[model samples]
Target: MNSFLAIIGRELRIGFADLHRVVTPISFFAVVLVLMPLGLGPSPQLLAKVAPGLVWVVALLAILISADRLFGDDMKEGSLPQLMTLSLALPWVVLAKMLAWWLMAMVPLAVIAPILGMMLGLSTEAAVITFLTLLIGGLGLCLVGGISAALTLSTGAGGALVALIALPLYVPILIFGSAAVEAASLGLAVKPYVLILLAFDFLAVPLAPVAAAAALRIAIDD
Candidate 1:
């Protein structure tokens, strides 16, 4: 756990160093949530119908925003070069960083879920399920988005590349997460959806880091 925890703490401290950079994207998540009620004219019916997609969409974008910066510092400071030659497998290290990144970005999104839910006219049950979906699904985003960041670290257009690669990957989670809430709103069982999200977590959590480590090695290969 030494390098892993060290990476987590290092990544997290760097993540928050610039408070504006650290918090602004999440503010975007919240602002998008806040604006929906106004845009939809505050009709509870309208809000209910659109809330799930809106929340997932904004959450997706929030993950994308943070993904680009995940490896920026390491790349800039030549740490990635050193990392490539480290004895440890790179993916686990990258995964640890993703965990920290998720904590910084996605957890905030979850914390603000109720407020976002209310703005979208989410029913109590729908809101709870949506929050659960996000809580589970956001980990997958961090894993996948982390790999996207690692894959693009040397490209000089990390942000654009991250969005291009990761946004499409996020679609399934978005679809299911929103669909789960829709099912909940309709009084249907959300068990399948939750299970799907957990499955995603199981797959992405282990696999994405390995892929990210490989990508980092490739990107830094001289």
Candidate 2:
């Protein structure tokens, strides 16, 4: 629909309008990857073994950090209410914004994840698996993050609250995403875990926007 596309375009403009918004997460992701080698000692075997989980954890955290700003600024600036009044359905608008966020934020993170995995000593198969899982799982992260962002929209303390609300929900994606790579590393079939992840994505992609729309409406009324 024209409205959905317009909303997506608008969100992309807002997202890139400030370079820091995109840079902060990528920088944080890189910094976390860098710290693992330093903090965990110089054990390549150890790093390789933990790389899958570590990458997923860092990516999840980066997503959370960005989610805090997803709607907070709009709420503060009073544009959210106007958006809600638009001709397009609020859920569609929310979905468009989330889609834009995923393209702008998650894509870059996903792209670097494999390279970072290689730097951390992940096997070629593991790195490829990491990339595949992230491609699917990252959307789920955006969906959940959108819901959290909407829920805590106008709350004075959003950052910690968003993490607390989103982290628990993120566990399933983390588990399956890391498990897929671990299975690949062990020469086991990753299809089951990947399927599980796809199931979550199927559920999340539709449900999140509607839930976020409801949360945003409640936020505006309050």
Candidate 3:
């Protein structure tokens, strides 16, 4: 328990030390939302209709943009091998790092998602749902993306490869996340979609770290 908290603290410090890791995803998320109006033209009805999907898709991509770096710094600093040898379980360590990354990266995106959704013409109800979905669904994104990052850690692949590996896995989250907001926008019941997204996060929280830890071992051994 102490060790898990310590790992999370160390990761948070490292993440804060390098601002790019913290800033890039948020910037990408905001920039894309800002430009969307230009590309799609200023039609409130159209933007409102598509805001759910648009926010979700951009958030997914924003999370993916930084996903490859989840394990990059640890590997480069030779800390990954040492972490594996710790008294604490490697899955716990992986979970700690994922939590830290979610805090530094996903939280900011989730926080701003409602504002961006409104810019895209989402109603107050839909915007609130947008924020909720992104906050929960982003964890699923980080966990699944962490697995991809661990799998390709030794290959020195960039975000492109990470996205390639994780995109298919991301489909369900995107679907449910966007659907929730869309349902809210239409004044329909959003509980079902929100529940599904929560289910994904619940499953990912315990399982993803183990899968990622195994992948890390393989990457380390190779």
| Per-model lDDT | 0.84, 0.90, 0.92
Candidate 1 at residue 16, lDDT?
Answer: 73
TM-score winner between 1 and 2, please give it: 2
Q: Over 4 Å off in model 1, which ranges? A: none
Best by TM-score: 3
Cα lDDT of candidate 3 equals 0.92
Error of model 1, residue 178, in angstroms: 0.7
Please report the TM-score between candidate 1 and the true structure.
0.93
Which candidate leads the pack in lDDT?
3
Candidate 3 lowest-lDDT run of ten: 152-161
Across 1-222, the per-residue lDDT of candidate 2 in tens digits comes to 988898888888887788889888889999999889999988989998899999999999998888988888888898888888888888988899899889888889988999999999888888898988998999999999999999988676789999999999999999999999888888899999999999998999899999999999998998
**Per-residue C-alpha lDDT of model 3 across residues 12-129, encoded as one tens digit per residue:** 8988888898999999999999999999999999899889999999999999988888898888898999988889999999999999999999889988999989988899999899
Give candidate 2 misplaced runs (Cα > 4 Å).
none
TM-scores for the candidates: 0.93, 0.97, 0.98
Which clashing pairs does model 2 show? Answer: none
lDDT score of residue 109 within candidate 3: 92
- Listed per candidate, the RMSD to the true structure in angstroms reads 1.5, 1.0, 0.8
Residue 63 shift from truth in candidate 2, angstroms = 0.5
- The CA lDDT at 170 in model 1 is 89
- What lDDT does model 1 reach? 0.84
